[model samples]
Target: MTTLASVVSCLSDYDPNALPVAQAQAIMRDFVQPVSGVARVPVRSALDRVLAEDVLSSIDVPSHDNSAMDGFAFASAELASAAGEVSLRVIGTAYAGVAFDGAPTAGEAVRVMTGAVMPAGCDTVIPQEFTQGDANTVRFARDAVRAGDNRRLRGEDLARGSAALSAGRTLRPADIGLLASLGIAEVSVRRKLRVAFFSTGDELRSIGEPLDAGCVYDSNRYTLHAMLSRLGVELLDMGVVRDDPAALETAFRTAAENADAIITSGGVSVGEADFTKQMMAKLGDVTFWKIAMRPGRPMAFGRITSDGPNSQGAFLFGLPGNPVAVMVTFYHFVRGALLRMMGATDAGAPLVPAVSATPIRKRPGRTEYQRAIAALNDRGQLEVRLTGQQGSGVLRSMSEANCFVVLAHEQGHVNAGDTVQVLLFDGLV
Candidate 1:
């Protein structure tokens, strides 16, 4: 049986660039791939795209100091020594988008509406609701207003030349609103990564096709396509390729010429009919071909370099044929690599802590990633229970599970109530 130690040694000694998970991640981290340069897109179409450059404010957000309420703008000294009743002459009126023609003098005030620019020499504002008004004058009930009350200062939201959006920030709805507030009509963002995906095997068929006696409808392609769509990736569906080497090679050549990355589910294991490994050896250098985790032990990573005029290169990930294994390995490895290629500096799987609800027995060698349903207990702590079976082919078990209860490489049988690390599929998928 392949053990975790054997797997680690094989991967570490395979090549200078191929190593254990940590080492591979470190190498990927150090090799910085340039983000595809920005494209000018309408603000409406820029949602979720990473900002290619910092956005500096071209003008103050509000543009001018304005009134925050429908009130009166007046000199503070006019009401400084007033009794319970204070009166002032109405000099002018101001509304949103219309500034007062002149400044208010010592004993006068201007009727200002919300968002109206404050008149010069006006230092205070009293809400109209709190004042007694007539044709030409208004009276305050008391000295309840303070200097600079009910005013939106110029540059309060954002100042000219201030950084409004930093580089590498993924735009969201609020970011769009902020940009709209600043009158920005367009933005520069990174283009989406184009990924080519397919499934291979003679035993697989499309969902609508008549199923042969032993063949099953392919599900991994749909699942992977959905996940990649949610990540904003442009997808090239290569469809299903049969187990013949010529067909597989044609698919690989097309993907290598067109896509940034090629992902295939199935045909990377130790079986004699596993033609993916054979083709990989002939077409590119297999960086690594096995992992130390269960359900996804037969994972392959390699690069296909072009040998023709107008040549280009691409990365390939060959996943095990089992439906559950395909999902597991994609989350653990392929997703991170894709995120890096998209210029995300801190992309990786998230590990969460959960307590076991039952005992789990396993050999003390290979790491176990058991399908589990995780829920919050009465005490609001995370508790996980294993799915029905642990077979790699148990796709239903994984579909019903919300998390993976992880057992370390050296861990043996775990007792009930033992604390373990659980990776939730919610965020990752």
Candidate 2:
């Protein structure tokens, strides 16, 4: 097992205070281990699940040479010497699900539909639209097609006995379709990861509770539930834990025993009432970092263990209490970590580039994720503009934006027409 001490000792430039974003990410990558259990599930139930083994194709994709269009199939020798127009006698008709049994002579053509198996001795197909033909014969221009045109050869898409999909791949919709084409009915995939999360603070209240002078309804848990659901993880919500050491420790132990990972929002800052940091230090090997980033600077990461013989530990992440900070932290850090725990080997989210529609104020030492709207400009080029407010506590900024303009740590102020990097919230549908 990889411990926090081993990971920290390997870092030559490790600094808990003012750590860079890349450094923190490296630490996280070094500390995580993928889960090993696998379950056999139907292809439909394996959506978004990571593959446990390679899936090889049992047969060729097309299984035979097929016609790619609704046209007449004939030997290319008949049209080789024709100057203006070529004509051939129609011998038989071949539909998509049926094959032509008879081989066509040199001057004979077989009427073929799309996906029909290519008739014997036929190497080319002339689309129906390009030809003017009758029931007995078909005529087309000499240059309409070349030899071997519009013919889908066997195993063009996927060859038999080849790997159709590899292990550690997170299955998407297109992957499911590919599996169906390969006649794969069931797949061995990693089991869904279980994550236990909670909110900590005396000032936080549930939905039905009355709003006293200093208490506000908790929104972090609701957002966490939705985000975790999108990531396809089973959730164990522990509700709000008061700002007491005993209650906090109880929540931690319970979460450690039941979940593969524990997520807590609040009580990790440098405030005097924050007992979470102390309890976390006592319970396990945890590290508090002040990252060089915006909206999410303070975070705690480590693993925690419970007492007794039957105890099993869980990975821990302490997020900030602010509404937007919680989401930003989750997306940038916890999301990838959870995917790794689920045994997925997909690369991190890709960042797209677009022109900045307006100027942006930035510094050189800290990375920032500014909420922005990415849309096409008058020239049909992608451009991005910041939302109304960018305060860490304002959740509306995140809602109003479709993408986050990622300003790098070494980047300075951006001009109006400068290109900026962005991570989209929605991909192509």
Candidate 3:
């Protein structure tokens, strides 16, 4: 039988195109099915949450024909005889919450404010700025106000029964306002995917803890937590787990039982102390162990199965220990998987093409993601410059980068000013 280490070693020898980034994403999405269910959440708690079903407008957005400006509401024919200026009787006044209730006569208009329903017979509104107004009379300027000017018709913003938002749309502030306008107090949103994450290895310590000779502060868990939080996931922080098998097993069991997915950094590689892979085999089936990529080559994915009466299956992702590698794999692998599980029909990191600001060297075997600081050049074109170093453990470089300049497996040695594809971190770093 091929050992896991040998399997990973063989992956580097395969053609990178054989398992292209797109194809790898498709495979992972296809393999790990979404947890099947929905939950109704209050609108107040729905921000940044994905909808499980389409949200239809319960009522017309404006609900009724109303005024868009605080001005005079009048019949269109009243201004016909006025060559340079027109004057009309202001029959009554209308505020935002109150309407004139009576229609305007041929030469009579109503004083209307913004958001007030237009009177029955009024078809136009001249702004108060464009009109001379007294206690009960208003005068218009030389310009003819168009019919329906300043009037917001009912259902203009959204028609009743129309889809206000499609399923799988991550709600934004504007979306929330739209929902409120339609009087939807609650929404059917997919339950936030519960992700339990942690970092492993005896050499890792939490921040503010005393650092020993060989130990480094745990940064992956916090980074992953922040990224997952931005995605609106329910994070179950398992803190830092040690390299021992018993501790690993306990963490795995707890995560599998409670979370929809579990993510861990380090110990998935070929080291002898890497007990994560071993624990996974004993508890869950390893779906695919490795991929052809730099800094994140030892990433793994699988499903944890259970046998209890209410046993639920959960997806698992193991990332490399290095801070930069953890970030790369999360964006490339974990984010895509989470999106798919949340019912996203289309989900992947956006790769934008940009010009290289300087030369970058690489071999043609492993696909490399170089941390780059991007800025628009003098011509208003996006240009990317590499950070100081490209090492996997360089957290400082990753912190300084706004995007990754993606160099393909077959592409070797790029000179300055070459066009390259860049994957922007998109404010998630």
Q: State how far residue 200 of model 3 sits from its true place (Å).
A: 2.6
The sequence of per-residue lDDT tens digits that candidate 2 reaches over residues 1-429 is: 788889989889888889888888888888988876899999999898999999999999899899999999998898876779999999999999899999999789999999999999998999999999789999999999999999999999999999999999999999999999988899999989989999999999999999999889999999999899988888999999999999999999889888899999999877737698888998988999999999899999999999945557889999999999999999988988888899888787789989999999999999999999999999988999999789999998988999999999999999999999999998410
- Model 1, span 279-383: residue lDDT tens: 776777554455656877776666665565543656778888888888877776777777777765444457888889999998765677899999999999999
Cα lDDT listed for each candidate: 0.79, 0.91, 0.81
Q: Note the clash tally of each candidate.
A: 0, 0, 0
Which has the better TM-score: candidate 2, or candidate 3? 2
Ranking by lDDT: 2, 3, 1
Judge candidate 2 at residue 191 and give its lDDT.
89
Task: Put the candidates in TM-score order, highest first.
Answer: 2, 3, 1
Over the full model, what C-alpha lDDT does candidate 2 score relative to the true structure?
Answer: 0.91
Global CA lDDT of candidate 3, please?
0.81
Task: Output the worst ten-in-a-row residue range by lDDT, candidate 2.
Answer: 420-429
Per-residue C-alpha lDDT of model 3 across residues 45-121, encoded as one tens digit per residue:
88988889998887887887888888888887766767788899888998888777777787798988899988888
Q: For all the candidates, what are their Cα RMSDs to the real structure?
A: 6.0, 1.5, 4.7
